[model samples]
Target chain A: MSTSQGLRAWLLTEEPTSRRQARMAAWYKGWLTLRSNTLAMLGLMVLVVLLLAAIFAPLLATHDPFAQDLGQRLLAPGEGGHLLGTDSLGRDIYSRLLYGARISIYIVALVVMVAPVVGLIVGTVAGYAGGWIDVLLMRMTDIFLAFPRLILALAFVAALGAGIENAVLAISLTAWPPYARIARAETLTIRNSDYIHAIRLQGAGPLRIVTQHIWPLCISSLVIRVTLDMAGIILTAAGLGFLGLGAQPPSPEWGAMISEGRKYILDSWWVATIPGIAIFSISLAFNLLGDGLRDVLDPKEGQS
Target chain B: MSAIDIRNLTVWFGHGADRADAVRDVSFEVADGESFGLVGESGSGKSTILRAIAGLVPTWSGQMTVAGETLGPKRSKSFYRKVQMVFQDPYASLHPRHTVDRVLSEAMQLHGVRDIDTRIGRLLDDVGLGPGFRFRYPHQLSGGQRQRVAIARALACDPAIVLLDEPTSALDVSVQAEILNLLTDLRQEHKLTYVMVSHDLGVVGHLCERIGVMQEGRFVEVLSVEAMRRQQAEAPYTRHLLESSINSIR
Candidate 1:
């Protein structure tokens, strides 16, 4: 038979009754291939633990995070009821770490959520629109990127005046440009895709094409980029708090605790060490999760 | 009345030192439901003419009317609903991330098609794909299957006209014939007008009612398949091309 005839026959042929089950079996086999990646499994585990810790912190911690006892100040780890020892202010270190996690996790989640939404809107419009709109939006993004992110964020914080809300606003504004750039690049690529053109040819408007075709395809990359950005936001928020520009004292911010503990580092290593470890662990968890998600979510990567 | 009418169409790209006219002062007419083929070598502007008609290449200056509606500088959604395009590379034409169902449903949804699942299922079956294949992504299918899916996508809006840009050039010859037959069947079934651009004369002869040979942005010769086969084309360029194709077959 000729090649076309063979293809027609193959396309037309009805499979046996068990073929559907076999296809499902093959799909599961592919899923199992992904599940077998050791690093991804470990990353997922770490992410779940950190998420649970952040979610159930109040129930998990023994003491009120903000409550203080002057007599308990500087008590070392394992001394009486001060399990992780007391900070310089005699605040319970363990409770503060738990509450500090609340701040760090909240900032990361909020920044990640808000930044990508802004980015998706800006990037999809700019990239898919192309021509003058693309040029104007991209140049604006370039201007944002030209300034060092931290300094730009610092200026925004200064303008807004220092506080948790201002710090979040500052970070979010600075952070969105990266997601915009990623979304724009991905949008540019997706706009040229046949499915998008096909939709356009089918009398779909620009908004429909972008929302239905371009957005869904670019979402995996966006999700991965947002996951990675979560780590950076956490670190940046902590840094701002450390510099006393965010989350004022006694709010149990990890960076504030570390900053307050710095002067007595030699006398009470536990104060800085506990929150520092928390920051390190949470950031590491996000980084690992982002990497695993990048691998798994990419259809091309997963296939291989 | 003609289903498509074009007069004095010229399409240019870039400006100043880099300016190039991709399609220049080309004109053609296709009677309603007629299968018209545009044939040429690469860079011969056959594809550009189709693009201009389909409203893809908006930088062209032209008088193009499809189904009696005057073509405009920018395409409208309603214009697209009437005329659609199928590109050469099936691989690049379909989004790999979407399942066959999503790919097919988008156009229907855009057109506010009611009872989308029934339409999609019927379309899949019409394109010779089983119901089981509807949920599979493009990458899961082979080249010919993807091309069939592309065809189904073009047909989804129930377009009266389709601009086929070398629709089978990327496929194996045998698969090309299948697509040609599928296109032929679809045109007859829907009474659709086709403006297909192709370099392969054999495939065009097999499918199109009339063929216009394009060269250097102009229609050098327009002939029926019977005229082409009977006269054996005495034009030097056409003769040369025929000779080369015959030699290749030998």
Candidate 2:
């Protein structure tokens, strides 16, 4: 109780003791605002559950997700120790859903890591350097943007050979164009700000100006944008998986599971419908979380 | 030698059909430890002169020298070490995400200054802000306080020439006097050369020893503060400017 009180005091302190403390307090304040938002909290809770389920999948699954008992095929939900039921192959739906969370998260993590960073560097450099450089980078971004996201991802995946890694790489290559556009837009505005000019007066070169001065301002907007893009990223990955271009058979990937269950979907709806529901719920969770993050992180709202 | 020298400085934007001259062949010199002011109406290019000196704008032809070093198309790191600029808007001048400590420390680090921890403490104190304010973000401070932090950041490099781009124009009238007084004290203490730009005649007069009146991108007159005070301006435009300034005050 005393420790909790001490932590609360520290978070609320106007005078922070160190740089770390100050940064933490600023972040804690953002968390406090986020906590007050109910829908955001709900979205955060769902994501937390998804993360936990992925981590504890082996321990939590009552049966091996890959084990196929042909006799038990097409069992309804809650029949014979299968809580969510069995797929057409008799693999437990409940256990597969738990493990599938890892694939979805992994793809999301990898795509998120690759796309926005590439976008940020490209956008900031193009925006700050301006002139021929701006024309060159932005034109390149425009070319990438001209392609439909899924079609581009599909084309890349087809060439790279079918697998989850190829799917992630494809999505990352397609996803970065929007981020670059956003970062470039944000950078164009930020580069003209007085703080940037002041930094330049300190003899900071274009690289330092873009990375240190301009990037910090651009990040808040980019973070909000990246969060909002998560749902689209998830859907794109799922589309690849459903098309049999991602996560090979028996991997229990949610989309692939849905693809396999499609044959039995008409007779026993739970097979495909269950994994479809899982995908829908996770996508909805991401949308909600992104909206909540937008409220907290949007610089235009003066929260920053 | 003068601390700052500019000969036949011509600054413009765009080219051909879209050309616009901001400062045209303007020549001026500021002696060591002198406080020079550029006063003009908006769009008269008072701030452009400072921007040219600080190397913020590239489309310029000029012979510019500061602290015994000549300026070229590109500014050297050592040039930045000897010169720094405080922007007009305090709110806009500070990095919103960075704390006051970070802003000050970054400026020092750029100049390769050591013993930062102690220097930051002293800088904050010098700007009349206490040590407790160091960790606070710009949003956490008032406009006046943010300006103080900006001033402190400029001082962090210990530049011999500190350019003031209408430092107090965005501040409250109540806070403006305090900031002006602080600028005066710091100038005397550091023996720094200043080239300040402002539209407010009273403000320019308060800080600068000599004031240049600009009209239509050219200097109409350069007069001492005493001459301005005595209304002894030789140029017809200078007299009109003084009259408008007095009328505005009245």
Report, for every candidate in turn, its global Cα lDDT versus the true structure: 0.80, 0.90
lDDT of 2 by residue, A72-92 (tens): 999999999899999887889
Clashes by residue pair, model 2:
none
Write the residue-wise lDDT of candidate 1 on A63-174 in tens digits: 8888888888988987868779998778888878877777887787778778788888889999999999999998988886677766866787778888888888878887
TM-score of 1: 0.90
TM-score for all models, in order of appearance: 0.90, 0.98
Task: List clash counts for every candidate, in order.
Answer: 1, 0
Which candidate number has the best TM-score?
Answer: 2
DockQ of each: 0.44, 0.71
Clashing pairs in 1: A194-B93
Which regions of candidate 1 deviate over 4 angstroms? A1-34, A147-161, A299-304
Worst 10-residue lDDT window for candidate 2 chain B reads: B91-100
Give the per-residue lDDT of model 1 (tens digit) for B1-250: 9989999999988888998998889888999999899988999999888777766677888698888799888777777778888989998888766667777877688777889989988998887888877776666688899999999988888889888989999999889888888888888888899988899888788888898888898887788878776756756777776677667878
- Residue-level error in angstroms, candidate 2, position A145: 1.9
